[model samples]
Target: MDRLEKMLVDIRAFVAEREWEPFHDPKNLAMAVASEAGELLSELRWVKGEDADAHCREPEARRRVADEVADVAITLLMLADRIELDLPAEVHRKLVKNREKYPVEEWRGR
Candidate 1:
């Protein structure tokens, strides 16, 4: 299986081991995604936008940020699996729509 599929299999086994499937309905999974995303945002909450990159470059700060990012990704993947959503296809479709909405020549510099 591909990497994503393997990850999903592992996640499923994890939840199964803990009997978490009953608590991981779509709504709860979506909420987990949002909560994890909020935690990720909180890591940079006090940082100025212009300095954000530099702040994240610090080793400790980078580790914390990376942990939050992983949490967000894991919860999002769980939510997608619960809903039977095709994340890769949906992301590709969204990017296509975004390109159409913001064509390069018209939006390049502005």
Candidate 2:
């Protein structure tokens, strides 16, 4: 299976092992997503512009950013699974919608 699929399998097992699915209502999962995103922001809070890219190159900083980003993604994947949403298909739909919402001719050169 693909990496995402494998991760989902592992996540399901993790949650099941802890009997945490019952506690992961939509509201709590959304809150967890927001909290994890805030943590991602914190990793770059002090950096500015192109400098933030360099900051992320530091091993420890990179690890921190990766961990926080993973947390956000994990929570989102769980939310999608819990809600019976096809996350990849939904992402494709949004991409199509955005192609219209942000027509290329009008947004090309910045």
Candidate 3:
């Protein structure tokens, strides 16, 4: 299987093992995504934009940020799966729409 498929399979197995599918409804998963994103943002709280990269570069900070990022991704993926979304296709479609709205030539260096 492709990488994305494999990742989804693993996530599915993980939830199955934990008997978490009952709790993996789209609404809850979406809320979990937001909560995880908040955690990630908290890790960078008070960090200046210029220093944000360096702040997360610290080993402990990086690990914490990575964990929060993973949580957000996992929850998002769960939500997408629960809603029967074709994520890659939706992303591509959005990108196309965005490109039309913000054409590169018109938006460059903005």
Per-residue C-alpha lDDT of model 3 across residues 53-106, encoded as one tens digit per residue? 898899999999999999998888889899999999999999999999999999
lDDT of 2 by residue, 1-110 (tens): 98879989999999999999889999999999999999999999979877998899999999999999999999999999889898889999999999999999999988
What is the C-alpha local distance difference test score of candidate 1? 0.94
Per-model lDDT: 0.94, 0.94, 0.93
**Residue-by-residue lDDT tens digits, candidate 1, 23-83:** 9999899899999999999999989999999989999999999999989988999999999
> What TM-score does each of the candidates earn?
0.94, 0.95, 0.95
Q: Pick out the ten consecutive residues of candidate 3 with the lowest summed lDDT.
A: 22-31
lDDT comparing candidate 2 with the true structure:
0.94
Candidates 1 and 2 compared by TM-score, better number: 2
RMSD for each model, in Å, please? 1.0, 0.9, 0.9
Query: Can you tell me which runs of candidate 3 are displaced by over 4 Å?
Result: none
Give the top-scoring candidate (lDDT). Answer: 1
